[model samples]
Target: EDRLLPLSVEISEIEALGGPLLLHSWREGIDDVDNDGEADEWEYSIMREITPMKENGTVKIDFPSLELVANGEFGKVSLYITGTDLAGHPVLNGGAPGVDNDMATLVTQDDLPTTISQPSISLDRWGNNLLVGQIHEFSFSLTDDNGIGSIDNISIALAPGDSRGDIWLDPLSRELSVNDNSPIHPVGLVIDELAAGSYKVKIQFRLGVDSPQSWNTSTQKPSVIVTEHGQVLELGSNSLSHLEWTVDGRVNLMLLSADDLSPPHSELFGNTLYLQPDDRFNFSGQLHHPANGLNVILDGDWQVNFSMDDNQNNAENWYTILSDSSSFMATSEIPQSRWNHGSATVQATIVGGVQTIPITDMKLHIVIDSTPPQLDFPVTTLSTINSNQMMQQLVTIRVNEAGGMGQNPLELHWSFRRHGVEISNMHGAAQLPLATDAEGLWTYSTRIDFDVNSDLLLPGDDLVIWVVGADLAGHPLEGIGTEGNSKMTQLRVIYFQPVLSELTVSPYQPTIESVFTIDGRVLNEGNDMGVVKVGLWAWQSSGNGGRYHILNETNLTLLPQQHAFFTFSQEAWDSGDLQLYIAINDDDTNLTSVPVGLVREQTTGEILWQNIDSPAAVGLMILLISVVLMVVTAAIRRSDEEWDDMDEEEIPPPPPWAPDEWPEGAGPPPEILTQSTSLLEEE
Candidate 1:
């Protein structure tokens, strides 16, 4: 059975003793799958991952099971325990000799790493002829089944020019050899120390193997094409932070490599930046500068500036920023007052020690606004108008500015909604560009009409009409009132009927042969129907002065609240009395034919108005006329008898009804005969 053991060795012999680590104590990446502080029994599993690098010295990794990643470019690599973390440096089975190198575990645990089934080596750059005194860089990648685990020693094994050195090699690059007692050179360089002749180099390195103190001395002759001149590196195009970088020009910029480090850290690719009000802007990027014939880093102080085309006076504004140190970081902020309340195109230009580049495609926008319009509706005058008679009443509207931005003439709109429903149904729409009168109010002479055939309006329907106003900036009236804008009072169309009243006639007292005029008014108390016809007539004495006759008749038309006048001139053919009457046809709506009468005598003073729709007065007037005719006949006989001297003898006996048979002392032989001597009645 295996048991734990304690061991110790000088730090200088650590490299040699770690060759058989699987047989001795530890072999790098051995771990405890279960957490217990002490190493757990575990077997090594081979993994290969192409870890990405930033601009620092180390790379961060999420998991060690990178068994699926293909070989990609990277820098220095180390080993890690599956469940073990490098914390307070607890000695694992006995601590690794190098405190700073605890991540390089080889002489601690007893788990053996998997052997390299296939070996491969790759070179990213080379030149057959190189500048004599120049420091040339070569990126050589080595691989085995378990990967180059925490490289312990790297040496050169040349057959001809060996260590004791018959030929010289650049000590700068040769320093990558494990022969040096210092740290390893990550970006190994080869200084030309040999003569201008061909030479062979076989590089061998030792790292963690399957057993403790057991090592694999893998060897490879990396192709070295050192050039005196003429060598080009093709790094096509790349993009970062919304800016596209084209490295095809004579002065192209490339992103070399990056690693994990602390603040002042740099990135080969720029960082994403988001800008907003009251927030500082922070951004960064690192790029490789180009030389005439060398693929190398150009490091120096850089000037970064930002410009916004949409800002006010933008042509004179430029913001200077900083990107200092090897890990360059260009950072700046946008002032709150600098916002233009509009979209703009932004650009950031980085002036490196050797070149200048303008990054395009940055867009931003800003805005600050809030408020509504003020409105007031005043009282109108014209009222008591008939329904459907055009609500043509005077209306007053007043408005103020919107959002404190002065009057909104160009952006204003108006609408008239009824009962809080469809405006179109009410024959209305949102008329844009504000329709206002000279006083800035909407003086709309509103009229309501309904076609009983197709319109939706109904009589006596309570219709609420509203006039709404708004601005293009989305400012509607405040509270808009409960009913909104303007409302209509109760209005309804109704039936019309003519009612006549207030009759007047000129010349209340008239003389014979004089003229008189009669006047009356007709009112449409209901909905208007049409004109009304009023006829005028009168009763007067006949030419014989014995009976009354209807004469002087005429007609007139009157509208609602209109006056009908009748003018007539009469000559007194003989002394008599007259009666005048007026009437309207009773067949039409609200029409009546009650005759109005007036009585006047040619010799009397006053005129009398009497309603005469009876036959009693007609019978009395006929009796009086008969008495006058009898008297006239008696007189005519007397005149004839006197003229011819034989009338009374020849004449027949008087009728008993005649006054002639009365006693001589009778009252003046009947008053009618005395009154009717020779005069006739006039009307």
Candidate 2:
């Protein structure tokens, strides 16, 4: 049976027919009819012959293999010949063996050459250095005689160790087709997001049904280095520098002020800064990459007078008021009127550029106080005390400083003087430390003790007291005094003839029935002879009223600065409560001593009697008495019931009582006999 071959068939299927399938051209006209080793006109024979292991007797056509070549451009690649024909001669310009001229043409997938050029890659921005957070385009190009349609697909991937491993190019792989008749084809991939790092981009292309091959540029693999935008370069004390691109070099600007300086001299309280009038306000910082080589300009309310220094001599040091080249520093005293406005702002800019760029800005609420601390003396200016006795007075002064409290230490200066001369032996011009009560307040309270006695102060002498203070900014105290001539008060020393100085009372918690002793000492605290009557007195309060009665009296005579002791005792007779004290009285003065003893009525008894006032104890005692009475009543009732229950026969005869056992009148009463006679009658 004869079979016809299909339009398309696999080589293996053709071989299953038991032999090679061959085709020959046939014509009615006779010309080289047998296709035997001859060349003739009008010939009908096989177009080409295949010979196994030997050269054939017919002409053969051999296709040239292709390889990739750099076109010395960014994104273009060229295809050239690499394989030769059977004669060991190179096939020039993608032509067959018979063709003499070079030409480019498109071919089908089945007619494609063995090898083709890979794609060349290029980036649209910054060559290989890319910035993060920006969109970039990568172009892939190829030049092949097989035309653009020969390419099946294009793929892009990132190398290992890349941070964006999960990211894949959109469409994963591109299926490219011919849009035009051009031999050179270009494809693009847009990457809109990428992480900040160095990455190697890999590109691949497949011609027709061939395996994918790697693609790269001429010098290196397609790569990119991504960096962060607007990166901070350096940080200094109270300043910062940022990197930014400009028409000039990269610009780095930093600003500084007294508010942000180290070892700060200004104080801030509730959004307002406090400063002294004499303090210097410093404004300084550095400026880098200035446009047109112009000096930095101040644009706001702050009129800074900047002075530049030669930076060549001090290149290793940071820019300050003393040295720098690209920096500015101004030291000026701020006016008090300007600082009183409650707030201020400073702004700087580089003005010589095409467009003004802001360098730095700072705003602060400032308060410059020229007035010193205010002092208000709350106690009397003059005080009087005896020569022998010591008197202490609390000198409280209310200080209202401009800034607040607890900023600095306040000093109290005191001195002793006789007439107009200061006594060097005594406490002269000494400082007393002060402590504040709280923080962040306008006023503070401090107290000092002023002692007046003969040891440091003589009769008719004076003790001078004053206060001095300063704020953190070195502002001195006001209203009270200056450091050299301070305002002060004097304490007067006088003569007190005799006084009951020390008094004692034995048994502080005394009972009403116990005797208490009152002892005292009379001192002559004057320069003249003194005589006084010392007496012990007791006072008791009653429902009617209260009165003091003299218990004992004694007369004493004391020389100047001499003291004597006196003792007295009194028997406690009155109940309730009483007070015992010693009193010294003279013709013109009467003085009472301290620590008067208080006596209360105390009852002597057992523990229960002592605690009789407690409700729990009283309740327990009543319960016990009720229990005893109930027991006695129950016993009596039981005895009566037994007596009544007994019959006259059960009573029997009373025990025989001998005459000797019955004492004269102590025998059983008549009631017993009457009961026995009644019982006998009943029986």
User: Best candidate per TM-score, number?
Assistant: 2
Candidate 2: regions farther than 4 A off: 1-280, 283-329, 335-365, 370-373, 380-393, 400-406, 428-441, 449-454, 471-475, 480-683
lDDT tens digits, residues 1-683, model 1?
22222222211121111111111122223232343334323422323222232222233333322211121122112233322222222224422322243343323222222221112222222232211112333322222222232222223221112221112223223544322321112233433212222122333221110111101122223222221112211211111111211122122222223222322221222221223333333433333223334432333355545555654554423644333322234334345576423333345455543322222222222122234546554444222334445433333445554222223332212222346453454443222233454533333333233212113433454434444544222345553321244444454544445566656656554444455555566555544456555554444456876432434445444454555554444443333344544445533233332222233444322322122223776677788999999999999988987878675456565446666567765565544422343445632
The number of the candidate with the highest lDDT is: 2
**Total residue pair clashes for candidate 2:** 0
Candidate 2 on 1-683: residue-level lDDT in tens? 11111111122211112222222222222233454423232342333222222233332322222211211112111111223234434333432211122122211222222121122344443333222112334443333233333333322222223222112232223332332321112233332212222122332211110101111111212322211111221212111011111112123344544452222354444334456644556555454333333333221222222322222222111222323323556444545443432334333333321222233322233455555566666555334433443334344456666455444455666666778687875553323344454443344333434442354566656655566666544456667544566554544454447876777777665666677677788889877676778876666577888766777889888887999988777666765445555667732234364364555667567334657857998898899999999999999999988888885547556647644466677756333442335766888
| Candidate 1 lDDT score relative to the true structure | 0.34
Q: Model 1, 139: alpha-carbon shift in Å?
A: 47
lDDT of 2: 0.42
Range of the 10 consecutive residues with the lowest summed lDDT in candidate 2:
237-246
Q: Residue 540: error of model 2 in Å?
A: 56
